[model samples]
Target: MQEYSIAYAILAFIVLVLKNDIKDKFFFSLTFILITLAGLFSYEWKDNFTAWDIFSALGGSSTIALALLALLGYLDYIRQEEEVSIWLHVKDDKGNIIQKEDTNFSILRKNCTRQELQGILGVIADVPRYELASIKESEFMKDIDAIQIGKKKKIAIIVSQEKEAYQFNSIFNNKYKKIEKLKTQTSLRIDKDSLHDAKKILNEVGMNFSEEVNIFTKMIVTHKGLSFEVKIHNDEVNDLTDKLQNALKEVARQSKEENL
Candidate 1:
């Protein structure tokens, strides 16, 4: 039993290492299944009257463990393949679906801070005006907004300003007769100062605005495909901007690790 336990542990470790190192799913699956079956059949079964001996007669404990691990690994591999398929299924400018291997689109990690999101948004927004597909506030959530940078990338930003939430909702819902009505209702206004500060943040991250930045009070933006959601808390804009640079650096590191 101790020998069998040691064998099972060694097999499991080998499988784990192979799963991480091997990128070709078909090859890995074939190799793993062959190895697992070989291990199972290599064991000799001897029948004894005792109950413990009966288990060994069917298949040694190590054989059963190896079989279970193979099954689990196969299931997990299928799940991973499905996820990759969904993310990689993207369309070209002509509305034709591009092959997964052909497309350069890489999915961003779902979990991102507001600052990190804003930084990404700022970088995308700094592109040529013709490159921007659309930018609009979310209809359902007041604090949530989306910007489509080019055809491939769409990002949603959700801020934690409760005061601005109601205003955005009113504007989006058509409750206000005129967008100018918002001027008197909210203390927070998009002024030159705010615009300048926003630009400064973008410049710090090596992104320069190619076109005039338009701050919209009321506009509808709808994105059908997958989008990365960014939730923002009530933090000072400058502080958020400063942290954004570091956050972006960390995100780059993580993305590189994942690709490896």
Candidate 2:
């Protein structure tokens, strides 16, 4: 049993080092506890083991215990910023807006009308007029819109049928050379009838779209005024700007690391 505990402790340390997810932390904690208890109850208690055996268990278990503490801190960091949102704006120095609200978001459901598009895009149309696409249902033209961000920088907004969001995303990728994609939560399922009601409400001012709409909005970013595609789990639209900035920085950091 003492040998088994030592082996388990060593294995757990290797796994914690290799895996980066939060779940791995839980795994390490469980294995650490089991090994600690096993060592306490096994032959080590009879004082039969050498100093080397005692040191091995203590060192390995202590490593895992410290890792467990770090993992808990990381989990709390994740919990602090849990909300679904759109990236309304991400700016760079020189006043060049890299990712702005108008250019960074698109929503697609089973059925979306022009009026609904107007309502969704209209919210941010005050200062500069939002360039709305004339509703088209042609075989080639999918429901999509464009919001200009800065000089030669634009974001595409697209709407698609259920499960077809990826297909639409592919279309965007093919058109843009370097694009980064960020995926947000799919809104609550919106039935066909509810979609119609949403169009009606969007046509009005005070009313808001119902939460039941099965909508998925992705932000496709341009790399260095070219394009780069990245996918991030969605959060609150209000808070997405910060997340987007973090993603952009991460990509840049990775590129730097790779070059080194």
> Which candidate should be chosen as best, given lDDT against the real structure?
2
Q: What TM-scores do the predictions have?
A: 0.23, 0.21
- Give lDDT tens digits, candidate 1, residues 155-217: 333322211222223212322121121111112223353455545655666544453322223
Off by over 4 Å in 2: 1-28, 31-47, 50-60, 75-158, 161-260
For residue 212, what is the lDDT in candidate 2? Answer: 28
Q: Which runs of model 1 end up more than 4 angstroms from their true locations?
A: 1-7, 26-31, 34-38, 45-123, 129-260
Spell out the clash pairs found in candidate 1: none
